[model samples]
Target: MDEHDRTRTPVAGRVEADDRPAPLPRRITVGIIVNPKHSATLRAYADLVPQLQKAGAHYRSMTTSVERSGRWQAEQLIDWGADTVIILGGDGTIRAAAPVLAEAGTLTSLVPTGTANVLSRHIGLRSCRHAIDHCVRTVASIIRDVPTNLRGIPVNAAEFRRADGSRHRTEFISLAGIGGDARAIAHHHFATGLLGYTWGAARALFVVNFTASTGATVGAGDTSGTEGSASGQVWSVMASKVARPAGPIAVFPQARIDAEAFTVVTVGPIPDRLIARCRAWAGIATACLQGRPQAHPLMDYRCTTDMWVSVESPVPAQLDGDLIGDCLELRVSAGEKKLLVSAPTT
Candidate 1:
């Protein structure tokens, strides 16, 4: 294998040049949290750091060994006075750091290295696949484009209340999962990367417990309006702030993170026949790829301040993109208080 291929997550196509002007080097301290599972290296970020250093930027770097530990590493960097924190992995890596940075009002940036770098896409960073010279240049351009005063858009987060009365809050900047989406997340192998998610989703279709038979009572109410309800068996429910899922697919095409409201989409149950299952899967996939919401009987869409789901039977759910285990009920809402985000600078 060539040196370029050795340092990157194996991907299609060749790298390209970064066209942005070089950013002025500044004397700043930067804290970096890298996910080793993605096979990122100090050299992988070579294009980004040197420019910062040219301006006299000091740096500290650490690799996260477990899920969510990147946040702890970022906290360490902040304690040591890092003026900015750079995340060098996928959305999960960034998610781990975002809450911490938001709470502290710290600035953050990304060098996406995951299968589907949703956060990177949201911030308008160009996608690069390899560690070749072209890839380096593209990343450098993104660093140059980093905005000075990052304005974080507000997002809806979910609060889950189990039948036992225990409750906890999980912030989902992009999408919140219920039913099959959550089950797929819970069942997916952590080591399998992107393919794991696909396989888990495919398998969920055949598994009886994951079928739409898992009933739910769904409700919606605007922040300034009256309460309403929608209930029945569901294959999955996604409360989305962003239109896309897993990258290009627009499962919630009308969802917007920057807006005060979000959308709750419930997938009607799958049919018992094999032919119907395959057709349902294909139809939903096609509609999503087209970036159009389906108007079929198998789906229902609602836009509101909050969407609540009370599961008839326990099923799994995901927050952001991480599997947060099973729950009896969940309430997703964009609360009055906004999360302070140190968004990308361009």
Candidate 2:
């Protein structure tokens, strides 16, 4: 077959000859990984499974538990030959399953069942929370030949090492950070959905310790370390693949999920005086909300492929809204894997 003949539709009601290339499947198989904590996810599953079955598509369902991670569930789906995997939770759920799915080159989509469905909003899904029945119908349509387009978005993976020499790796579909923003995520637990994120950010303003300045160094490559460190007293650093990690709050308005790079935002130390600190953060917040964040003396935003960050001591960290505890070193690289998502319908 020539390069142009990669995709071909088979003749209806007939099988192809052995010498000819096989056509696309008559029906697609979908796998759903649900966060059991969300009752809405359970509701959507009940409504979705029947619709998929009626459309002649095969499907399998798995629930996330305290003992089992999304990675394990996703691996099961891939082994079962799923044509598409539907994640029915928030950014954290997506983060857990995405690396495995991306590595396997499987098509994926989301239903936004958790607080701040940032990926859905970034991909133009708009609504942070969707009705269960509506989400069910949308998933059904996409799997049943609704002519929706596919998008390949970059995923950020990190290798983290603690001051005590323990190590682990993680991936994020939206945003990750070390410092004040992460403190907000750590303190974020009120109401539900976007309001909780807002309340958390508000609560952080009064309690978060901005004095722990990470004398951080940034290197171009992932392997470079702290011997030749840049002398900046950054209070926090955020790296994002999407425009807004918190819904409607644009930390990096210029960010594009489909792009092969990451937008890294760094915040400098707050003022010593109370009034001065208030004014400084107020200015930064205003600029970010307006969708044009100015390069202030205390803050900076830049695009890069990979970055290596080393701090003076253990400090707060987070990935995709989930806290990463304290870390002394972090290496974040973009475009390591790209997950295919169904583009939102216009």
Candidate 3:
């Protein structure tokens, strides 16, 4: 409630870092949102309630499976005098609640329970991927104090409206692109788990590589009839917000989570004459694997405040690590939202 009551937490053992801490509210009315399907999330919720009570906090918990997207639930808690929100799920759950929480002016704590807790690592919370007990205990043990705000990465969120007259909004934390990355995300399945993602990436890489080797040209295009625009044969382009994604492959090391500008890594300008698609894709792949994107001429990584990309084809756009249906053009720029976060203690 006051400067003297603010607590501190060390975060070096974790992968990422946090800048400052927020004072814990005196009343401590907490709103907790969980996803019941994740057994780890359930276990963490059980442990979290006791911890909050022992700390003299009043809390209410709800599962996303029963409450849809948790958007309305978050608003309800805000109306009920809850100043802090604890989300017990993976990246998607946290991301889904982000825009709402930002507008509600509530501080949020993340207990990683899903498959790749990418943003958690940046905020001093690291949960082992798919490890239930370890993750559950980790989530419960880290609510030491009210956390501070996190500088949100900018994203060009695309609206994908379906024929059923329904609309879905998705968040892109790290990278979004066309070509192999998008194709691989489209092929991924939730039931198959991590294996599905690995296979999808592998298949995408090899398929692109083989197609290049045979001198096959994959359809690529840029926009015209708008201001001054330079055109290149675009094979693939990734707009990066963070230095690393879910894995070790640093596709956009130049990108920072809190950077004012995001990086756009493009690979292309394929030869008009017959040439190996394998060679171009391989060069892009190598840069990704080594974390040094400028290693090849075919790959170009640039930082910009805004960009416009016209694919000119109907293809699923990969936002963050998943596909977000079909779209034509992309408008990339800095977002207006700022999300407050409570980073876990060291």
Which has the greatest lDDT? Answer: 2
Candidate 3 lDDT, 121-233, residue by residue in tens: 66556563323233333334335442333445333354444334455545544556656567776776733766777777666654331011101011112233233344545
Whole-model lDDT, model 3: 0.61
Candidate 1 local lDDT, 1-346, one digit each (tens): 8776764343457443443366664455678787867654445576666655654557888788775557788788889987667777776776667666767766666677876676567656665333223223333443555445354655456788654668997565667777887777776684387788887877777654343322222333333455666566678887777776675677777777666676777786777688988898778777766666566667678776677777776778787778776778777777443444344345
The global C-alpha lDDT for each of the candidates, from Candidate 1 onward, is 0.66, 0.74, 0.61
Off by over 4 Å in 3: 1-25, 128-172, 206-228, 269-282, 344-346
Off by over 4 Å in 1: 1-26, 41-43, 128-151, 161-166, 208-221, 335-346
**Candidate 2, position 143, lDDT:** 56
lDDT of 2 at 239: 81
Better of 2 and 3 by lDDT: 2
Candidate 2 residue-wise lDDT, 215-264, digit = tens: 22344344464433354566678888887677567778778888766787
TM-score of 2: 0.81
TM-score of structure candidate 1: 0.75
